[model samples]
Target chain A: MSLVTDKIISKPKIETRDLGLEMTENNRSLIEISNFDFFYGEKQALFDVSMDIKEREVTAFIGPSGCGKSTLLRCINRMNDLIEVARIGSGKITVNGVDIYDDRVDTIELRKRVGMVFQKSNPFPKSIYENVVYGLRIQGITRKSKLDEAVERCLKGAALWEEVKDRLDTSGLSLSGGQQQRLCIARALAVEPDILLMDEPCSALDPVATAKVEELIHTLKDRYTIVIVTHNMQQAARVSDRTAFFYLGKLIEMNATDQIFMSPDKEQTEAYISGRFG
Target chain B: MKRYFHEELEEIRSHLMLMGEKAVESVKLAMQALLESDIELANQVMESDDVIDDIEKQIDDEVVRYVSLRAPVARDLRLLFVAIKASHDLERVGDEASNIAGRTKKILAQGLPIDAVARVPRMCELAINMLEDSLRSFIQEEESLAYSIVGRDREVDTLNRENFKELVELMKSDSANVSACTEMVFISKSFERIADHAKNIAEEVFYLLTAQSLKEVTRGK
Candidate 1:
């Protein structure tokens, strides 16, 4: 017998764009995964993971330490390509109906379309304008007017234009921690990525800074698909439209953020959300 | 990690059980006052009603505190929701006990007449048993036992109905018996309302267990 069976199923046919189709107003899915598995050398990091990332939505990954939430976030942009021993086995990851892992897909192009921000404020040691336009410079776009326009547009998009516009030529490190993080976001936006992946982006910031970043995230989802991995349950509840809980390399539960936080179906998910255990 | 909300919830449960016990004792004492024509027991039931009222306020304050602070959900939410309801029922039980005490006072002031206390005492016993069973079902989370108490409501209903008819017949047979019969009717009505409140508590227990409204269940039945 085949391991997978192709069963014929029928669902109510609804038009995607019809206003009268009884569809939810937010009806776009930007990414979908099916039975995805990830491994680092001999050890499996993710098992049978499947979920969807809706466009213009904030999806949060939350779980205990070593639960592979960060690993799963990396899979969206193939960040694991930088890890020598990491491998994907027996699954598919698609972004806007394009298979990301296909041989024909250019990894650089993929990264351009899917940007990422790290936990720390990793602003390069350069002028603020140069940091925001670094990706364009790497692509050999040397027009000064174009770089200036891109800098202004990206900084404004990141809600950092007012604070940094006066100091565009100053060193990126001169900004405060929260400003630096927003600068990193501006840098990511400069690349014009369709999706943004943040891995514990506010874990190192103070509460005030964290609140600013969280509010920025909530605003950013109007333009970019956001996938964030956070260990803070309250942060996940506050920011994400949907949340997935991972446990020991397995995807235990995934649902709307309210359901996940307020009344999760799985007992383990409930315990974790209720702070019974990590 | 502190789980302060869970601790507060447990405290509410303990206080509700304590209040339930006090309400039951008040009902029993008021019945004793009626049967023995003892004004002292009647006064005790009235005094204890104040304690029940105090605990009801305490439970209400704790529930509001937990809701505002923790925003408890799922089973915790259901527990708190039912705690608020159960406290209201217990307070009303205390009120019913006070009402019974008032009836006892009136009957004692006017004198018990002659040989007419037996059926009222029996009806009081049945109503108190129903109240005790209902509270037990609530504290134990026993839905089946709660359903059985729901079944027992009909017995109390029948007793109250029959007792009402018997009192009316007594007043008709002797016009001088009107005042005492009227007092007996008031006492029987209080017992009937107590049974109704006990039934309501049992239904709330069922809701806490099943998440389905008891009103819906009876409508279906």
Candidate 2:
């Protein structure tokens, strides 16, 4: 056979540091954390963590136990204020070009714009319709037709309207585990929050239910900036656009979910994915 | 931590080397038998073909088991995949060796004067050397050496074509030697096939080392 002599073009090597950096100034992130640090009393939790959460994209936080993934999630909505010893120092968290922690910033107004769903589905024992309209009612929306419309819109947005529409008068606790979680999501959306934080939202559910919750998260990203904290590596892989890996209160690496799952830049991330000592 | 994966890989390599050595030895014996008209040595090469067939089956089984169990990806998977292809080519090379041996037996039984025997022995030697080099390149993971072997295949094709024309002239010049010349033609065809198998081995070696399709690379050029 005659030998062919074409030159092969090789791909250029990209440095790890160059990845995940937003190159253009015009595409500024919706949420930006600049050298953020957190402390519980004298014990520090997060150290010089800085990253961006882009607008309308799902960003997943993953790490081993006690690595501050949940703590970091709570810091976004100032949920750490519930803890007596919690303190944030040395950095700033800004959403839509404004700092939420400023002295003049209103915590109540900030919470209305940043809603959250907990690990467990902690629905109120009240009726399903009351649970969904609870946030709107607290905002002083008392008109019956407005509350009814908001309830329908938010339930459909959470992908739970069809199942609970006939049972609007039933107790929120009467629904299954997966439906209750979606009820919690619908409650979070009832406030019309710009950013939604989920802390292991599917950890308590089975695989089939978890798939439904994951699908809901994907649908929610069209209108809201979503940040999720999950211990399940495969769940993060299947849902998130970008993933951040935290270890020992430090942000080890963050990149596109595909890169983190297939070939992570950090050795720790690789070890975790390969099932070699988390 | 399974030892069987690495052990099977090493076992496959050893069997390939043994088969390669047998093919070289068969060609050498066939050439010697042709020069001395030793029908006995020619018959010995033909009778030993069963051993080559048995080794081919063994290699095939080892490759299939490793692939089904390991499900290896990237370089490890490429090596196992190429091992399967190389095993088939080596089996065909064994078949070519047997054909050469059978032709040597026929020419010896006829007791005819072989005019093209000199060129035939040189072609056989070149084919055997190429096979040996291709295996060495695989064992060493030398991609450059593999590419060089692939580049040299055209030389073997040229030698086969030249020998075919010269053998035809011998048959036309002496009508009584038609049967022997026909056997010589078969021997030349066997050498050509052996060269082709060596070229295949080289291509597989290149693929196993680089994870690039050799056919695509050559075609792109």
TM-score of the first chain of model 1: 0.89
Global CA lDDT computed for model 2: 0.80
lDDT against the true structure, each candidate: 0.83, 0.80
Model 2 quality (TM-score): 0.54
lDDT by residue (B53-90, candidate 1, tens digit) is: 99999998877756643557787888889889988998
Q: Report clash pairs, candidate 1.
A: none
In the range B37-137, model 2's lDDT, one tens digit per residue, is 77888788777777877887887776665554344568777777787788788878877777777787777677666466767777877888899899889
- Chain B alone vs. reference chain B, TM-score for every model: 0.93, 0.91
CAPRI band of model 2?
A: incorrect
Candidate 2 chain B superposition, TM-score: 0.91
Which segments of model 2 are wrong by more than 4 Å? Answer: A1-28, B1-221
Displacement of the residue B163 alpha carbon in candidate 1, Å: 30
lDDT of 2 by residue, A47-118 (tens): 989999887888999999989999999988777777778889789898776666665455555666779999
